[model samples]
Target: MTGQVSVAGLGPGHEAQITPEVSAALAGATDVLGYIPYVARIAPRPGLVLHASDNREELGRARAALDLAAQGRRVVIVSSGDPGVFAMASALFEAVEATGRTDIDIRILPGITAMLAAAARAGAPLGHDFCAINLSDNLKPAALVEHRLRHAARGDFAMAFYNPRSASRPDGFGRALQILREECGPGRLVVFARAVSTPEERLAITTLAEARPEMADMRTVVLVGNSHTRRVGGWVYAPRSATVSAPASDPEGDA
Candidate 1:
């Protein structure tokens, strides 16, 4: 209603995937702040303002949105997937709190998260117990990331890895594969989904030892199947129950 800031999730693909609510909010928003690609996803509307920036400026971008809200201007901090899940929502609120600027009312609208989208596209890969982890060490230490990776691998939990690898941090993915091989064994199934849901999307399903860390990039998400993951329709997912084929039909009796 009144001037406020909303953190909107744009999903993993182009504009069509975004919910109607997010689209409306973006239309009404005086300004939208986010990464360049995310901003470009939405068509240019009259009287709408766009503030695109590099990935590292997420915190600053959120702070700007909050400030605009404080001035009675509608703002939206857009992210690729669900705002709260490894997106800009956390930084937006944290900056507002750190600045002691609570005057701006904030709203967060949910959207199709990459992990969930990947699961649906790859079959029921997440039907069972699973966890989401970001492989990038920009916000956290590599040692801490390694510790978490080892624990997840040992627990045999299905894992959806965000920001799996990038040009800048090439070794992160390699280190993860090494740890998973040691803890989950070499034969464990893993799924490599790149630019998922987009035109350039690519998928590779393979075993832990068979998976190549070099296959990942900034726009990729890697799903590490648990002990139960199996191949289905060219993808890998964890099945809830054992598969059973039906008995042969009595064709002669029907005739």
Candidate 2:
């Protein structure tokens, strides 16, 4: 009895946002593994076994899931949003590569990522060319983060950021805001969508000049608009067309 593993997204904390494919995977899974909060989203049932681990244990969790699947147990790994976007699907593949376990069955299911959910809730801030970047320094360097920010701003691409700040890195987001202000100028639109689709959801719209580091935390997704992004009525959106601008230069001579 060969078993399979499915990496599925639950879609940013709303049960309604969860797709039918993910729901069906959960219903048929004999074992589910994920971060503590994500695994908690799965309901307990007669034959389903849940394995919850810490946020930093993604590789180990993937290995455990693969191990279970190799033993003929149907497994599902749940991520809050789309598994491939800064989530478990990549980690699972990394584990597969490291272990050379190409024989195990694997499936990647798509779901609405937090940035998209946030963008939708706010209107269409991502309506134009955009890029998503994770700001956490857990696996990357701070200099690299600033480098990407500079390029994104220079290219005038609408930007979405995940893991903007946390208690441990209290000042990183402040520094990021400073870089954005330098490259994009003071009037560029910025939106902070926190816990979108949940009961405690909050949305704040402002500009690079007024954006405070305190407005964002680990749970918040920050959106910085391109030069052409603007507010219409009460909603914010980027136009579908692009007006190329000269390459941006740092005002402060930091570059």
Candidate 3:
């Protein structure tokens, strides 16, 4: 049958926040492929085959899911956040596209992204227009990250940063801060969310200048505010965009 396959979001850090539909899809799945840490977040659902892999073998893990799907197994490829949002969905599609095989049906059941989870936990700081950028240079050049950061500042759009820092890419976090500072100013609101939905979760609301590299990790996501986003009542908030109401036209008279 080449069963319906999916890259499921496990929610940011815990099993409780997993959506019922996603959980059901996973429960029905014959196999699941993901990094070891995210795989550990799932409870032992019987009859499910786990293909846990080391974090570094992203492509390998994704290929495992594709292989399982090709085998007519209801396979679920899990990700920490929404699979499409800086996660596994793209990689899966890319892999299939490279192989020139789109015969397998793939579905993406969305889940709570880390940025959204963190934003809601604090406040609606992303109420306005926003963009998310991955700071990791492993896939893209650091210069490209800097260029995007510069434009985001000039456009005055709120931004969420994914993969803010890691041991291999130690300079991404600091460099992002530097570009934002150069484009904006020192007082802009920046929130650092770590281990969202997990026991070790930490959320810090501070300015760009005050964000320290020591607290950031691969799980960390940084939200850098536009000029409008403000910190009040221990929360970060962005005001709604202004919209001018159009003058109502008389239905019959205008005609």
Using TM-score as the measure, the top candidate is 2
lDDT of 1 by residue, 1-255 (tens): 347989999998956778999988988888988999898886777888899999899778988887788778889889998998999989987898888887778899898998887777787788877889998899999999998876676556789999998889988889899888877778888777787789998877778888887888888888888777888667666888533222122224454
Cα error, candidate 3, residue 159 (Å): 0.9
lDDT of 2 by residue, 1-255 (tens): 668999999999999999999999999999999999999989999999999999999999999999999999999999998999999999999999999999999999999999999999888999998999999999999999999999899888999999999999999999999999999899999999999999989999999989999999999999999999999988999999888776576444554
What is the descending lDDT order? Answer: 2, 1, 3
Candidate 3, 116-234: lDDT as tens digits: 99898779889898989988888888889988887677667789989898888887788778878877788989888988888889998888778777668988888888788887798
Segments of candidate 3 deviating more than 4 angstroms: 242-255
Error of 2 at 94 (Å): 1.0
Tell me each candidate's TM-score. 0.91, 0.96, 0.91
The local lDDT score (0 to 100) that residue 120 gets in candidate 1 is 75
Superposed Cα deviation of residue 83, candidate 3 (Å) = 0.3
With a 3 Å backbone cut-off (N, CA, C), the pairs that clash in candidate 2 are none
Error of 2 at 155 (Å): 0.4
- Which one wins on lDDT? 2
